[model samples]
Target: MSKRPYSAANPSPDKTAKATVDAVKDITISEKASDEKKDDESKKDEKKDDKEVSNFVMPNYLDGSFHWSYERLASAALIPLISTQVIYGAHPVLDGVLGLVLPLHLHIGFDSCITDYFPARNYPRANKYMAWGLKATSAAVIWGCFEFNTNDVGITELIQRTLTA
Candidate 1:
């Protein structure tokens, strides 16, 4: 039987080696191109992030040390205020003080939640107006509570009766 010079069953070692080298070179070139694209994409993403951060504006009330301190103090004061109302039972003075602090606390806490969910950036005028409305409503509520406490069973007692009954 005569042997073939270049058959599929008897492939040359040099040809196989050359093919393998070419495939490797092609793979390396593609990988280099992909890596450069990834680097460019990452740089673009970083620039977008920097622009967003620079443009971001925190609310004025949230930015100040005095507001932070006041919020902290109000939160701390609630513990004692609640404890006194619970243990000693509600007095006129306690009810009056609670009326002042509690409504403000509720307004601030709810307004903060509203601010977080519905940011000023999305609703600039609405956010400001909403906050003002909250403050005004809270003030009115406090005033109403004060009037009720002076005229009737008081705020805590009224809550107790409502719950029990």
Candidate 2:
């Protein structure tokens, strides 16, 4: 084996061994410190995540945050609306309300499907186009319902007429 070149800066063998031990001890201490830091950081992250999840603010009714609530309320409203229509027969007010609510309920359901199937992260262009198309279709449908309720026999009458026929 080639001998290492010795210089004034180089320590003697015993001193070199002591120095190596001290370096190892320093490194181990530093590693422990770093590990503690990592644990602290991870704990902080968990706390932040918990805070974010728990601090939900109710947004405006028009916002996506309220979508599930709106959908559920609309669905619940339908049971009473339909029940009243069946028991009391056709009323213009009920027909108009049904026309509005039914189209809106359908729109919400279809919008959810589009959101699930064409998520913006995976299909940005398709998602945008589909969302706009859905908006237009829903608007047209709601408008058609309004027109029919105003100018024709309206929705409940049409349903009754169809069921009887």
Which number leads on lDDT?
Answer: 2
Off by over 4 Å in 2: 1-17, 28-64
Worst 10 contiguous positions by lDDT, candidate 2 = 56-65
Once fitted onto the true fold, the runs of candidate 1 whose alpha carbons sit more than 4 angstroms away are 1-60
Task: Please write out the lDDT profile of model 1 over residues 1-165, one tens digit for every residue.
Answer: 986699887778888899899999999999999999999999999999999989957567657555666777888888898799889887889888888888878877887777888789999998888888888898899889889989998988887788789
Q: lDDT per prediction?
A: 0.85, 0.89
Q: Cα deviation in Å at residue 100, candidate 2?
A: 0.9
RMSD of 2: 5.1
Steric clash count of candidate 2: 0
Per-residue lDDT tens digits of candidate 2, residues 23-107? 9999999999999999999999999999999996769744576899889988998999999999999888998898888888998
